[model samples]
Target: MAILPEPVTLSLICILVMMCVKILMDQTKKNKYHFPPGPRPLPLIGNMHILDIKRQDYTFMELAKTYGTFFTFHFGRAKAVVLIGYEANQEALVKANYDFGDRAPMPIADDFQKNHGVIFSNGETWKITRRFTLSILRDLGMGKRPIEERIINELQYLNALIGSHNGKPFNEKVFYNATPNITFSILFGRRFDYDNPNYKKMIGIIDDVVKLTGQPEAKYYNVFPIIKYFFKTPGLVVKRVNELNEVLHEMFKEAQEAKTEDSFRTYSEAFLQKQEREKATETTEKIFTEKNLLASTFDLMVGGTETTSSTLKWAILLMMKYPDVQKKVHDEIENVIGLERPPKWEDHKVLPYCLAVMHEVQRFGNILQYLPHSTPTDVSFRGYTIPKGTIVVPLFSSVLYDETKWEDPRGFNPNHFLDANGKFLKRDEFFAFSKGRRVCAGETLARMELFMFFTGMLQKFSFTPPPGVKKEDLDLTADPFFIMRPKRYYVIATPTI
Candidate 1:
């Protein structure tokens, strides 16, 4: 064998020495800290070897039973706190919001975000962008009439599309893409035809990104980027994110070129106005820049599109499973508003059962079951210390499924939102829209859209499994994805009216 160069041999020896020392120091620190109770971690790999990446929540669920409400889990070399139960989560997320008020750094998410926008950003970036976004939802109309009316109007198109389905089984695509088409019109001041290929492609890309980024392989890539060459996911994800951002930028440019003075036709215009105002200030660290706007707009569009669609899927699924509830909703709509007119947002108060069904859908759906929240500063909570930048996952599923909080947390029961008198009741455990300062900014828009779409569907067609299929045969568990999306099933939308 040939002898290696002296410099190369020396460098390799030095690197090996450093890595050994680093591992030893990490082991020492792990021993020194008063970390929450959990399983012992192996050397170098930490607890990754024991973690069930495909079903992390299940693993967490089992370990929590052993370790109690508060515990720690290691993701490769990194460790994070898992907060279970309503009190543990509420105290950390709401009562001590600022202490746990940052977004965790994921290599994939960071690559897509580049530290821009509200959803994936923290500190001043999040604060300013969120303020700007909330302003659009609060002040004036998204365009023309009020946001609720806009949603109600768009319901006609979805209603027509499903009507065309002729009661056959249709995938979530129509239901999923409907909200995005409406929001895109609101954002870009234009609408895509139902068969518009570009719009379809964009929506499909976002769907893939959402699901792929949440997979166990994603964690592996984050922990080991060198594995990227061996696997295709990282590269493909990056390409798709670029494609999405490029499309958003183009749409924004088109909107900006067509100047309008009539009170902000689209969200893009409103965001541009903010960007211009901030740009004229000429100060560094001005959060309202083009990249931020693009990221924010993209974030809003993706979020606005995906969430309600997922919730509505669960809604229809539940309705099909419980024909009694579906009939009750139809009866409630006919009694309260009648088939002459669609369900309006104001009619929500009187249609208590309808509203209850909607709430139960969201609460039980709990699509955002797993989330990563970060501590921007060293957080000392409940006699434990969580260092700055530590990733904390406040289990929304825990709150939604807490037996102490819900009468029947596991079942698909709408009575959870109804009282003895059959009136709608609100529960504090309903954190489906999330809670605290970091709650979903699009809560208003999402709620209106869901209420209208859900009621509208039930009003036009009664949902059920295909002929000869029983409710018990339907699967309740979601497809393994970022969102708790229900598995593929056939639904017949028989004309109820």
Candidate 2:
């Protein structure tokens, strides 16, 4: 009977051998990978339990204090190495530049077929997109007359919107929509009319999506990838992103029809021409298509809109909290360029306090709190070995609020950017736009937008808290997002005129 069953016995023995091999492989993997020290983790769940979840700020800062500048944390199956403090950030971003240049592959990125736009793409694709984006921006008259002209147009529209209130207490959010829309126009070569219903609805969707992004619920989705199917929040993000894509696609379709092959005029027009030329090449695989053009355009629209607008929103909130500083800034702007005209990008040279105030807003508000980077290969920095594909976050909060870097790290002080004579002075550590190869491509445009739009608003109106409100009582606290935006609060825009 045993001799007759030899084949079945052999099969059973092979199954046991395979199970043993898998166990040995798993154990070897655990032993071979030496991760950086981190807080105690639960089996399978890892350190997610220890994480503050909602407060990435508090969690990261506290982890740095306990585990040193560089520590590791597990996001489900994936491991993330956090780099805290200025020096750690420098090591990852500068010293190990190329090594820590890759972005972690996520489900969203994968769903996009890993064909992420310039901001998230790695290696050659990223290089090509970034280089071309810079060149195109310059060609489209970034840092030139076109930029100033567009800004002035937008400002005139914004001023009209604000002035419609007849010096009454109207919330600035409606008018503030112009700031982002202007940048969107420059990037996509299309502008939204003031009070456009579709535009307002799009903004509302984006607001909700952005709110859900930095929340615990979003973080929960990130941790448990399998559970994403059951979640509504992540689905909402995807839906909003798709809606944004549809909007951009329609804009692109319009640009394509309006495109004259003889004239490569706007960003979209030039990009479409380039796409056509490259598609004619035998190696069509490498050519960036109209899709890439639209995606890149979308990147600029989202990045520029969210960041620049949020910073300015926070600026008004800060001014409300410190009315004395606000008055000084108002007085300085008035003294330099009177209320007859709104502030222009050119007026930045004379408006020292206004310039300083903008810088202070960027520093103090610190939107885009920490710019996350990732290691592409093994790198040794100051004797510590950084393994391949480790997340290298530049603690932007640390750089923005460095105690050694700033005299008043906690305060909203425009003097932070001023000297004894009150001239605007730039700081090397002010990495608001970040630094090196991966620094923000749209920084020049964003800077111009912020200065022009902010000064434009302040020149026309002195923003004050509502009646019976104390400056101290003004809630300057942020709405707690991936971008630090002030909580919704109405202010009286007393006309400076």
Candidate 3:
């Protein structure tokens, strides 16, 4: 190679020196907006080793004790700032909601194409789907007579099922099927017989899917997208996804064949009809297509099914533990609506203690741990700069159990929802349905289902602990996932005398 001229060499040296200086400046630039503090992390893996997926709650609670409520953590290369107390949660979730509310598009969820669905979608798609879903739900009888009639029918069938027990020590799980079955019926405009094999398989798939969500390996795949391309072995998460997809496709195919334009037979039909009409007109894109329909229906089935059912299960368990509270609820029902008539939705207004128990059950259950969202654009919050696209997690669980807000945060107490005069009280801080623009779209439907199914069941049966088991023996351990539910156990459902 020929030697460079003196002038050219000087110019080349200047360029290289400038590049070095620029990089040095960038490295030294302080991230003025610091994330919440947490345990010191290692390089590459960050705080990955500290997490125990199977017992995530215990680990996180312990971590909170050491690191305080507001803390920072890292998984792989991604940094997460966790808000752990009521104040931090409220400040981040409500006050600076615009900075927070967007769900992070994790890789495994993206592989399942969940980012397009309302539950997982971010930005414009979420906003549009959320608005449309709420409107359609109202039209399809979420808080209307149609849904009310369905709940009453379900209660009638369950009353008969409980009658069949003949005061024997029957396991409550058998009767619990009615709750999820009714939810499915409302969603698909069809119900599965309790003995149906397909229905059993579907329930099993849903349970597995929920369990896999809290798996460390599954989380690892999300944090590191490249792992999926290279792996040849079938992952547990992949199998769960396949099972869910099959169920969704079958349901959608049936809905499509039965759909009509004039009447709203089902939620899916209403969406399909709208999609067909929209197709005729020139459109930028089709948001109401079959894929979105399938995903949305599946989202509803997942969101509505497990949460309310689990809460009901926990309520029964808690009532068994606190006999005095359960007795008070039963006495109130007897005083307001006699044993001959079933507890109707209208009676909820008059029965203060019963309503408080329901609210307390949901509050104590605390299904969602961290409701994840992402920033649509750059936002400033509490003197910190929240960059665009940063994943903002709303720690709803922390808020529900905050010591300052609750009288006995660690204990299960229905009195938390009661006032000085023994009337049912409602607080804005009770963000179980969440708040702001990204709050749950199915709040009304959830409320209706919880009230109808819960009061209906309580009226017909008395929940009691199994033989040789004390109320204190019941397990309160919750499994970590998208929803936090109690560990599996059997209970005795005895008929009320």
By lDDT, who's the top model here? Answer: 1
Clashing pairs in 2: none
**Model 1: lowest-lDDT 10 consecutive positions:** 136-145
TM-scores for candidates 1 onward, in order: 0.90, 0.90, 0.90
Task: State the lDDT of candidate 2 residue by residue for 1-497, as single tens digits.
Answer: 45555898989999999999999999976565666788877777877877766656667777887888788877666678877766777766777668777866655433432564677677777788888888988888887888888888888888778777775666647545776676666656767886677677667766766686776667677667776788776777777777777776776777788888787567777777777778788984673875577567656766777888888888888887887888887788878888777677788888888899999999888887665677788766655666788766667877777777789987888999989998889887788888766788888888898888888888887887788777778776667665678777777777777
- Prediction 3 global C-alpha lDDT: 0.73
Clash pairs, candidate 1, are: none
Clashing pairs in 3: 102-373, 102-374, 103-374
Model 3 bad stretches (over 4 Å): 1-33, 52-69, 170-172, 225-234
Instruction: Using lDDT, rank the candidates from best to worst.
Output: 1, 2, 3
lDDT score, candidate 2, position 36 = 76
Candidate 1 stretches with Cα past 4 Å from truth are: 1-33, 140-145, 223-226, 260-263
